[model samples]
Target: MTTRDPAARLLRLLSLLQSRTDWPGPELAGRLGVSTRTIRSDIERLRNLGYPVAATPGTAGGHRLGSGARLPPLLLDDEEAVAVAIGLRTAAAQAVGGIEETSLRALTKLEQVLPARLRPRVAALAASTVPLPGNGPAVDGDVLTALAVACRDRRRVRFDYHDHKGNATLRDVEPHRLVSTGQRWYLVAWDIDRNDWRMFRIDRLRPRTPMGPSFPGRSLPPGEAIDFVTKGVASTLEPCRTVATVHAPVTAVSERVPPVARVEHLDDQRCLLHIGAAAPLTLAVYLAALGLPFTVDGPPALLEALRRMSQHCAGAVSPATPAMSASQPRADAW
Candidate 1:
């Protein structure tokens, strides 16, 4: 019948509340071995410390944690803690923009508090895994965070954007989501000026201040964010349309062509490649490297480049003198 210490009891109460939603006053008091009045006091104390605890109405009223501005200390079991630590380490190496430092800081703090038994496993995983370098440009971490917050809050944002051609313009949009493509990040937003959805590369965005007033969340454009953003990006690349009849199946040729390229099956052994590149020469080299026979049509320049390259390659392997049979060579200074 002795009461638990105030700090320990409070922590225990918080853990119990976090474990589930809707704990009736009597049930909570019974679990804590305290009076219903004490349970109510503890709920108030949790609220004072920035936890949003809501009370349900009716004869069986209970307390539940609601959304709040500030985050409360999380109650994670041993395995959950390890999973989070590993995820943080992965993010620290792979996250786009300036989030690497922030992730590393979080990871360090998590490792510091991890139980000694779990430390070595986490450390071993961290040491053994090697991250490959990403080719995409680094985006500003603050810009990404701000846009994400605005998306969650259904707020409008304005930013200075430079298009693929390096044209600068100011844009106002209602952000719906931040899509990460492993190498890059994209913002899928409803462009206010254009009256349509548009995708912006996070690295090229220079978000302006005052984020704009809150707006109602808008339904995303008629497809998955990944598909929309990828198609949008393909449309902006340098125009180098080259069509060729490749002597390969559509499946085989497609594996070599850029994802944006269109392929049409002419038959089982031949397919048409409609790809865009910066120039004909670049496209020709790309096709040639696929090791498939292809015939280029249109843009006579591509055919000429291919011919020249073919001759050049032939010359490299050709010998300066014709081959001779053994014993046909003369003595050096006879």
Candidate 2:
């Protein structure tokens, strides 16, 4: 970690400072193979180049990189450069309202400066990757930024929200975390008036300026934020709910179901799937589409729906076609 070239030494020093919040002066000197006086000089040089290098003077004094008025050039290694480039490329295809263009601009700049050896790897990835078209509405970037800031500061927010039925109402809430379900964005927060935790659709809410007063953070309801939002959304949209014993590994079942459906591991050969839909028939159809063997442990209605579906499917088959035995494990039957 020692360098004789002054410019290279300064760049190495900057990288070290950025890697951690604080470093003892002696440790910095030792790492750079320089005296403490030389480390002090290097710190000054970094500051002159627009890097806010803060120093504390004393026996145990250290140096730290602080926030500056403007961003300075970052020194990223080969791996970091590739990672950033790929991340930006992926983000460029997302449905986040105004971020696609910005992400593309950043990706372009990053690729232009990437080391020659790394350029091919990044270019090949960009050439091979394809993102699915997002079906969700675009979320306002300004609103997203404001909500993030409020959540970080634990501040109350006032916004006008529209319900599923298109009813508009004013809401004051203590901002929590924002969750993205790939198709849509949701805000998980505590409602001031309702005195309960609620999940709001980000695209349907307009944040009011001059947010409400700062509030003490509250412990989120059981499970992670994503779990809470998904469950809430499912309950609201689908009234019929049931659990099924799916005869498949958890990973396989997880890959087949949507995020709104919760899958619990039972054993190596089976898992429990908790899901809901507007009607028992709809749920039955969804399960059948999985093309996997499963048995429903549900309300009588769901079982009845599956019974009717089986009969209809059997009738549709030609009489000459061999019938499946009752005990046979059909890969496409549930």
The number of the candidate with the highest TM-score is: 2
For residues 86-147, could you state the per-residue lDDT of candidate 2 as single tens digits? Answer: 89988888778989999999988888888899989998997898888888999999999999
lDDT of 1 by residue, 1-334 (tens): 4257877788888888889988898888998899989988988988888889999877778999888997777777888888999888778776466778888998988887889999888889889988877787888888888999999898899999998779999999999988876777899999999999889988898999987998986766435676676566555673666778899899888776655666789999999977656777876777777777988876777778788888887887767766667869643220
TM-score against truth, every candidate = 0.66, 0.88
Candidate 2 global Cα RMSD: 4.1
Clashes (candidate 1) = 0
Query: On a 0 to 100 scale, what is the lDDT of residue 182 in model 2?
Result: 85
Worst 10 residues of 1 by lDDT: 325-334
What's model 2's TM-score? 0.88
lDDT of residue 165 for candidate 1: 75
In order, the Cα lDDT scores of the candidates are 0.81, 0.90
179 Cα displacement, candidate 2 (Å): 0.5
Candidate 2, which segments miss by more than 4 Å at Cα?
A: 221-223, 278-281, 297-305, 308-334
